[model samples]
Target: MDSRVVNKGQLPELLDKLARDHTLIAPVREEENVTLFKKVSGASEVQLDYITSDVSPKGCIFPQTEKTISYTYTGDTLEMKEQDEPPKTVLFGVRPCDINSILALDPVFEGKFLDTYYLEKRKNTVIIGLSCSTILSTCFCTAFNSGPCDGKGADLMFTELGDKYYVEVNTEKGSSLVEAYSQYFSKGDTDKLAKAKEEQAKKLEGQFRRKVDLEGVKQVLDENFELPYWDKVFKKCLGCGICTYVCPTCHCFDIFDYVTGEFTGDRFRCWDSCMFPDFTLMAGGHNPRPSRKERVRNRFMHKLKYHLDRYNLDGCVGCGRCISKCPVNIDITQIIKDLKEVGQNA
Candidate 1:
């Protein structure tokens, strides 16, 4: 429960030190408007001023494309090889919404069927969550009982307090790191700093422009899976899979083999989306979700109802990446609002 303070100027030094010890992944401005989480060697590469990265930091745990296994054929004999071990990693500057998304993902990969590829990386990485200073019009983390300074899944959390950062160690891993770098962190006035952090969180909470109401959304979907709502919502969808790709919680994927020659090949697992027509298509030419209506309905149902049914967790974290990236303006906030209206009428 002990908290420490780090002067704003000392952050870069801390990041540099962590990078030297572990694989440090943080937000980097790749281009003018594009920011993504990438492995950095030092603090000079980190972009701490960004609102949010264009892509979620989930890639650090679950890579977009990974070779699960490799094989080689020699005459009549065959050999197989597993992928190498994941590195010890430090994921820095993850926002609360994305951190919540990582919580939602834990059960999925750690449940009945264990995904070692994801589990290995998750086990090795330590997360350092950063509190949001600015709330965008699309953000709705409050709907999920989270806000800018929420630190539910992080090992450590950092909240900006003017010229310094109020650092709270949330887990043993975080405590270990703090102990290792004792020189950089100093004990601060806990009561006063906690009050200031709370005030800052409240101020950011009021800045969210999106008001999302989830009451009866799952119940409505449970009762009315074949509603006319699907027909209307699917019409505008381009099936580009932008929403799923940008979503922090969307975890659908596909696995296949690629041959480099007749004798050598690799098996890969890549991210897939339900919005794609082939996602639910079977080998016998049977497509369960044959049209945009069915696919669109399935996507929302997965976010609002199905995932919760399976994992007992909210599938969507309300990060608003899907809202900002959708070319057709098919807003999830609008869908939730409309679903509430439907529930009331019924």
Candidate 2:
């Protein structure tokens, strides 16, 4: 619960120091209007001004294409190898919405089936969440009990205040990091800074254009799985899978073998989307979700109902990446609003 202030001028030095000791993953300006979280050697590579990255930083923990196991066979002799150890990592400048999205993902990978690939990276990484300075029109983190400055899943949270960053150490990992780099961070009046951070959070909370209400929405989905709303909602969907790809919480994946030679190959798992037509396609050409309607329905159901039922966590973190990216504007906020209306009418 200790707080510190890092002068804006010294932030680069701090990041460079951390980079030398750990794998620094932060947002970088790849091109015009494109920002991504990549491994940076120093603070010079980090883009501190972006509203949000084009894609979620979930790739830092769970990669898009990960080889789980490699196998080699020669004359009935088989050799298998697992993935290498994950590096000590520092994920910096992630917004609260994306931070909560990681919380949504934690259960899925750490459930009955212990995913070592994701867990290892998760264990080794320290998240330094940055409070959002600009709230986009598509943002709706408040609907899911999170906000621009919420620090639920972060190890440390940084709130930019003019020439300095108000740093809140929230975990042991964060405390250790701060202690290691004590020179960069100076002691501030914790009481005043905390009050200022709260005021700032409240101010940013008011800027959200999207007013999302989840009241009775999940219950509606639970009661009426065959609602007529699905018929209308799916009509506009192109089944492009863009929403799932941009979503930080979406964990659906497919596993297959990649052959290197006649008797050697690696078994890989790549991110898959429920929006795709073949997501539920079976071996005998029988697809459970044959059309866009079912696929679309399943996607929302998982977000609003099924995931919570199974994991006791909200599947969607209301990051609004899906809202911004969806070509036809298949908004989750709109869907929730519609579902609530349907529930009332029923």
Highest lDDT: which candidate? 1
Q: Candidate 1 clashing pairs?
A: none
List the candidates' TM-scores in order: 0.98, 0.98
Per-residue alpha-carbon lDDT of candidate 1 for residues 1-346, written as tens digits (9 for 90 to 100): 7688988899999999999999999999996679999999999999998897799999889999999999999988899999889998999999999999999999999999999999999989999999999998989999998998998899999999988889899899999999999988888676788899999999888888998989999999999978988889999999999899999998988999999898999999989999999999999999999999999999999999998999999999989999999999999899999999999998
Off by over 4 Å in 1: 75-77
Give the per-residue lDDT of model 2 (tens digit) for 209-316. Answer: 999989899899888878888899999999999999999999888999999999999999999999988888888999989999999999999999998999888999
Weakest 10 consecutive residues of candidate 2 by summed lDDT: 185-194
Worst 10 residues of 1 by lDDT: 184-193
Off by over 4 Å in 2: none
TM-score (C-alpha, index-matched) for candidate 1: 0.98
TM-score, model 2 to reference? 0.98
